[model samples]
Target: MTDSTHTIHPVWLRATHWLNALAVVTMTMSGWRIYNASPLFDFKFTKAITLGGWLGGAIQWHFAAMWLLAANGLVYLLCNVGTGRIVRKFFPLSPRAIVADLRAAFRGRLSHADLRQYNAVQRATYLFVIADAVLLVLSGLVLWKSVQFPLLRELLGGYEAARLVHFFAMATMVAFVAVHLAMAALVPRTLLAMIRGR
Candidate 1:
């Protein structure tokens, strides 16, 4: 967690992270197309196709991407269990270091130890993104079949509630990706590390 060093992200971590990114992007787009269908708004869940030729087809794509995301996410989580990367390098809760990082950022500089690594802000963003993805999966399930999963539906305050939460969370993630990309562009070397194993 200092400067003057570079520890490459393991290949498995890089692979799962990028694959998951693609899956999330595809799923969000296709899922939005599906939502344009019935929309479940106006106090109704009537069958309707809002953005595509068929709601069913959109559902298929959405489910496919969802599964892909799940697989990548699973691998990422499993790798974390034994890798110690989560605790040692990625958890993002080191208060003192975080404070220092903030100070450096305000001064338009990277903390000495974070020059070649994800800074505290980056670590915090990554953690939030991870948590948001988990929420997306859970909320999707809650909205998938409210009748079949009564307990989950109830926990999410019913299908409508779940749907709303899921949509908002998905939108939030989309926004995060937009911001993430801008940051990547600003710090090209950091992006290079992910793509070219720098």
Candidate 2:
């Protein structure tokens, strides 16, 4: 297809992408502060890096970000489905293709020549992160309202188990974000494409 016939990142996608990014960052920082209030482990995130000055404030920030994430995520998912971008971009995944892509990536031979199409690794990773975000939201609901969501709480193996699941999900998301940013840095055009929709 000619350049005039396609856009790398559509406007709705770019909007949702930036909004989701903002929500995730806010939730993560506030979450660190909330986690510090009731230590799940001995370690604590530094006050400097965490959001909100106190536990109550942090909880407020976390809740606000939660709503933003939920609403924006819904829009993103619906748009992807409605537009059929989800299937076209992330479907037909295979273990063999992913393994080959991984090997090529490690060897610095994976191609990013096509700005519009995802390789097997990108498809897998994006799909994984989407599921991870859903898990985070479900587990977070249990923690946020255990009394109201007792069934969900029990399904996740009680309150404490939900917390653990949420923590791990957050960690996984953070790692994904880190690698995503690294890849963007390595291929700056990808970042620009998201912004410019070229």
Candidate 3:
């Protein structure tokens, strides 16, 4: 392909990507604050203290960010599919090459194509993150309004089970974001590519 044919991610994607990041991070923070209300992971077995300020306020932020995040995700998915970006990027590939990609990535030999350095680990991590996001949202709905989503609650094994999945998903996503940030900082040029759409 010529220089003109180079695949620069569309502006819509770049905008939505950053917006989604903001929304998710906001929601995660507020969600953690509220989780202190019950403390799934950090919940003390002793006394309940409104550690972050107020439960109601944290919930307010959670719901507000949820709407924005959902909107951002919908547009990202729709446009990527409608424009063939998904097909181009997510299509099935050979196991052999995937293994080679990982070996190369760890060996510091993998020069990313089009500035997207998703070797095996990245590809798998991204795929799981998307799946986990869907699960987190669905499980959240079940917990948010169990009466309205009884079937979903049942599918999740129960209200408590759904909550457990939601909690773990949030924790996992935070870890992923931390690792992602570390990688981004380690490769400043890679970050520039994302912004410049190279």
Give candidate 2's TM-score: 0.97
Q: Candidates 1 and 3: which is better by lDDT?
A: 3
lDDT of 2 by residue, 53-105 (tens): 99999999999999999999999999999999999999889999999999999
Alpha-carbon TM-score of each model against the true structure: 0.81, 0.97, 0.86
Candidate 3 at 158: error in angstroms?
1.0
Q: Which pairs of residues clash in candidate 3, taking residues 3 or more apart in a chain or in different chains?
A: 39-43
Cα lDDT of model 1 by residue, 85-110, tens digit? 78776764777877887788778786
lDDT of 1 at 123: 79
Off by over 4 Å in 1: 1-7, 39-53, 92-103, 111-116
The per-prediction CA RMSD against the true structure, in angstroms, equals 5.1, 1.7, 3.7
- Candidate that scores best on TM-score: 2
**On residues 81-169, what C-alpha lDDT tens digit does candidate 3 reach at each position?**
89887767665556777888789877988775556435566667777787878888899899889999889999999998988899889
